[model samples]
Target: MQLTNLNMPVASLLACGNDPGVMTTEQAHAAMQLHLDCTVDRCLVRRRARTTLVEAGKCVLDDQAERL
Candidate 1:
């Protein structure tokens, strides 16, 4: 079940740094199929919290509420 050979567009999407939100249903299906084939024991995908520069400690914002 090695999906390395599967025709998944995941690598291209990842390279562009764009979220997979724009992917079509067919593309999503292809990616899912690839993932299922390649998964070892268990696999999970979770969304991390979206943070701003101030929250990330990269800057001190006077209007933190606005950023949030």
Candidate 2:
């Protein structure tokens, strides 16, 4: 199932640029909804923004250590 269930529009071709801006999922969704008139996708936002990731073990161990 889709996150927002709105019809997603295809992203237009983008030229290579020296600088690109970044935004969060919520922010991207809002911008697309307002400007593009489509929800696009929650997952694609992360990929386009190059978000960071953490290993499951690292996250779980860090949380456990903090609680001790």
Candidate 2 Cα deviation (angstroms), residue 39? 13
Q: Model 2: C-alpha RMSD to truth? A: 12.4
Top candidate, metric lDDT: 1
Backbone clash total for model 1 is 0
**Winning candidate number (TM-score):** 1
List candidate 2 stretches off by more than 4 Å. Answer: 1-20, 37-68
Model 2 lDDT per residue over 1-68, tens place: 24244233323212122112454344334433443432223334432333211221212235543343
Tell me model 2's lDDT, rounded to 2 decimals.
Answer: 0.32
The RMSD of every model to the true structure, in order and in angstroms, is: 13.5, 12.4
User: Where does candidate 1 stray beyond 4 Å?
Assistant: 1-10, 13-21, 37-68
Q: List, residue by residue over 3-61, the lDDT tens digit for candidate 1.
A: 34434444543322334444333444444454443331232210111222234454343
Q: State how far residue 19 of model 1 sits from its true place (Å).
A: 4.4
